[model samples]
Target: MARRATVYQVAERAGVSIATVSYTFRQPQRVRPETRELVLQAARALGYVPSGNARGLAKGRSQVLGLYAFDMFLPCDLSAPEVGLDDLVAQELDRLGDVRRFPLYVDEIQRGFELEARRLGRSVMLGSGTSRDSLGSIDLAGSVDGLAIFPGGAARDLLEHVGRGVPVVIFSSPPMHDPLHHITVANESAVRELVDHLVEQHGHRSLAFLGELAAPDIGARFTGFQGALAAHGLPVPEEPFDSTVLTEDSLRTLRAAIASGDVPDALVCATDQLALTVVDLLARHGLRVPEDVAVTGFDGIIAGRLSDPTLTTVRQPFVSMGRLAVRILTDTARGLAHPTSYVLPTRLVIGRSCGCS
Candidate 1:
């Protein structure tokens, strides 16, 4: 049997000390570039991969960052010897039916996070949890030096609990867990600005916000919707789409509103995904976008660009937020005082959906 290549072998082959080999992987910036290259070249030759457990035991740190998410990661159920067709069909449906589930905000944030982790000479581990398991986060927290988590209300307690032990960064949620760091954009102000544009320039009178306030960032957008309506002397809705989350019930209400042919002058969605849903619903009911009901979304995801009207919306710096989270986690883990929470900026993008073309 072949032996697993050890760091000592790489160190010997590179003609460097063991510490230099460790620093080359754990903290590459501290090593001279030529020396780092030599070590890496030796490692490649010997198929030598640094051991996170060994590194942690010796240096008190794992050179791996975790990106934990809330049930967003799903793969074919391969626990069995072979996944049956029925299981595969259900898995694909489960992946597709989930709106904004993947290849959107979360994917964009992960791309940024991975990029930053690589920049810092660290590897990233993606951990995902379903609603059924609260312990998923606990197990992941134990394995990584730092973690960047996607926000979900169900994981609030777990997030706070993990923050106490590890350098944790929360993304796209409120700063309710003050002890933990956050990488969020200007949710309220960006929505406020987007809404103000609709009211002032497009002259949208009866504007309705199309998402629930259960999510903190979505709630912030709703607040901006109310603020803009009040500023325009328009009636503010006490509840949004039955004051519920994005579930079947709210969608039913949206369908009924469209069916009755009494929809608002404009629909300001909490997310680009919701805006796409609205666009589809309106089309199903024979309503034209902008010409009949103007629509706008908040997140500047790629889908919004290809939507029939090319959605007008606020673009959050998803990638930048990701990069910033890694910085916060790595810095905080280094015995530096906890970093301050960050609020990155957003931009209002004018597109055809809002009649801006």
Candidate 2:
């Protein structure tokens, strides 16, 4: 292999001082445009790339933002550092069909985050971790000027800890009483509107909420389901069905429900991931969506549009949510704004899967 070109070589070739080479890349506005162009031209000729780390250290800024997702787990082999890049965008391409573990929500949001970061001359590092291990989140914190986190489990505590030293934004969690910056969606109202459509328009007597209650977002949505039932004067189940995805046990339980004629007229799922998988599960048992039973999901992922009967669901502003988080962090980093929390909105999407024409 050939030897890598050094800054000294670039500085010598550019007919500029070493300091000029550094300023040209790190603070081009401080240098003459022609000088910056000369250094860039020399860099291209020598195939030399300046080190982002060194430049960051010089300017007391990393110029990179961190996005640490909570409640994500990986297989043993995938946890190894040498195995793969810790980026959500690259991983999302092949996960569309893996409904239980599909990466649509985070991928869409990350696309917006990444695009804004690029536009602002910042780099982004994406990471996923569970509460049991925090080394990944910490390592990311050490490298970023600001960080965005998904709220859950011990992550709230971590968010606070990181916020003490740098700007932090947490998204998709329960509303916090504290003043820490956060981003949330109108989960309850959105689901309530969805269920309202099922009862008021379709005259469905039996509507069951389907999802695990451990997640705060699901809990909020289930509350909406209960509220809608109460408004219609219908009997509401004491709890949700406790199954969302198509796992073996969940499938077995659902199959038994069908066998015993206990199936509801509609299933209000907490997420598109669960609803899409349940659609497939119902088909295996010869149940037709919106005919034999209706189904609705939250989070308007793209795959919902392609389902046999296009999914009726609520669409969260995922891209805007992401873009807003980055804006908050970048603004805070530059002293342009103070950290604040926000509740984003969602809209109900009309589609055939919910028994609507």
Candidate 3:
């Protein structure tokens, strides 16, 4: 293999110091236009590419930002249809296979992040983590100037550890006692509107929230659920159903609820995925949505839009949130003033599932 060209050779060919060549790439505004052009021409002639690692070492900051998500890019398993999948579920699977892609809420946010980062002349380093391993597995601390994390599956200790040295912006999670920056949606307000719509418009007296308490966003939504009930003088339920994503366990729980005749008037799921699954499971149990049991969900994912009855949900400003996260990270990295926390607005979308015509 031939030797790769270096900045030293470019600087020699341009009759300029290495610092001038560095500024030509890293900070062209600081270098004269004529000098910058000379350096560029020399670099082009030598076929030299500036080393990002070396530039970061010299500048004490990488020009790239890190975005860490939990299982955001995990490939969908389309090998075979699982047994007992309803027609709707199978149709969704077929659509995903036809497109050869399925994107989660995190992927939408990532698009916004990437667009804004590119506009600001920075790049993003995408990373993924899982519950079984810490975010340290990605090893992004020294590589990026700052990090934006969707701290759901990540450990709090690990987040704090990473934030100690890097400016960390936690998105889509509840507020933390630590001083780390946060960017979340208006979970309380959106849930209040959703629940209020159910009670005031649909005359739903008894309602149940389905979500896992372990997740911070779900906890926030649950708090909002209670607040809405109190505001309307409705009795607060004892606890939300302990559930995560849609799974066989969740289906079993729904079946049991139906069999025992303990179903609520309306079930407010913390996520669209759960609500969609609940709708399918309820249908399998001979229960009609809205007519028998009203259902609503948070996070206006695309799957919700394609549901049979369509999902009643809170549409979070994910694209705006992603752009804001990148702006915050870049501003903080540059020692500029930035809010420690930002809560964006959300809109309540009434669909057929929420008993809306």
Candidate 4:
């Protein structure tokens, strides 16, 4: 039998480091194009067969990146208020069509991760998440090398499972959950910008945040709002000024604020969907937007533009986030030093809702 060619043999023949050879095969971006091509040509010339089995044995899985939502429903419907973050993800996916070819699949929890297994070409698989409960779908992830999860209530369970060997990256707004890589937004800066826009540019002193206060984002945004109020010498209320941390409760809190005459001149929502809902709800109460209560939302989505008065918001760049997740997962699979955390910037988009140009 011919001697089995090691990665070292491939590296020597291709005139590249073992890392370059690995990068050439698994993550082409890390290796220079010319070097990657040379390595590939040398691999072919040596009649070297890259053994998926051997590779799996060496790394414990193929170069499959797993992405999961905590719930299967997040993929198909974003309007469901209980899972508003899913709406943010939906907007992000819309923009991610061109970055890389690694296909994405949403797990239904019915079949094994069949959709992902077939579409991925040494690719990344996004799962709903293991936050609320074990995705039982994890059984299908034996072929995945790493996972990017949007954590929920059952995050700890999922974290424990991924600890079984697979590297885990958490896509969230955070202070870095230990042992899990995080990709977050500049939540504080973005929220501050929005508050500044609402208070300074729009000249609205009375403001409200429509979101779940339990979510970490709530604290960051609240802090920003308070900071803006302080900067402008505006009063920061001592009570809950229309804050709801859970998605299911957001509309109710907003509706109650409207009824109680406690509605702010400008309401900044934690998400686009909430802002959209506020628009509809306010209109139902016979109030004219901007003329009555200017509103701002986070996460720029298609629906935001179609609203009666287009929403002004902090666009979280979801597509960019998805693409970044893929890049990180792919690099990690190739044994590269992926950045410990990635925090993307957000932009304040002006629109009629916030009475902006």
- Clash number by candidate, in order: 0, 0, 0, 24
True-structure lDDT of candidate 3: 0.83
Sort by TM-score, best first.
3, 2, 1, 4
Candidate 1 regions off by >4 Å?
1-50, 73-102, 242-250
Q: Which window of 10 residues has the lowest lDDT sum in candidate 3?
A: 71-80
Per-candidate alpha-carbon RMSD to the true structure? 5.7, 4.8, 4.9, 10.6
Candidate 1 displacement at residue 71 in angstroms: 3.7
Candidate 1's residue-wise lDDT over 35-75, tens digit each?
A: 99999999999999888788797789888899988744423
Candidate 1, clashing residue pairs? Answer: none
Tens-place lDDT digits, model 3, residues 111-195? 9999999999998998876745674524886689889988776777888888888888888776668867898988988899999
Q: Who is ahead in lDDT, 3 or 4?
A: 3
lDDT tens digits by residue: candidate 2, 191-257: 8899889988998988888887877788889998898888889997888865544344565556778
Residue lDDT tens for model 4, 1-357: 988777788899988898888777766888877898899888887777676755677666676667666642432244535547888688678867421112212222212233333444655444453444574436435657776666655556656677466666665547565666777778878888888877777778777666655656656766777676778788875544665543454567667777887777888777676677778779989887889899888767666766668888887656656666666666766678876778878888888998865
Residue 54 displacement (Å), model 4: 8.6
* lDDT minimum window of 10 residues, candidate 1: 71-80
Candidates 1 and 2 compared: the better one by TM-score is 2
TM-scores, all candidates, are 0.80, 0.83, 0.83, 0.68
TM-score of 1: 0.80
TM-score, prediction 4 = 0.68
- Superposed model 3: Cα runs more than 4 Å off: 1-5, 8-47, 71-101, 135-138
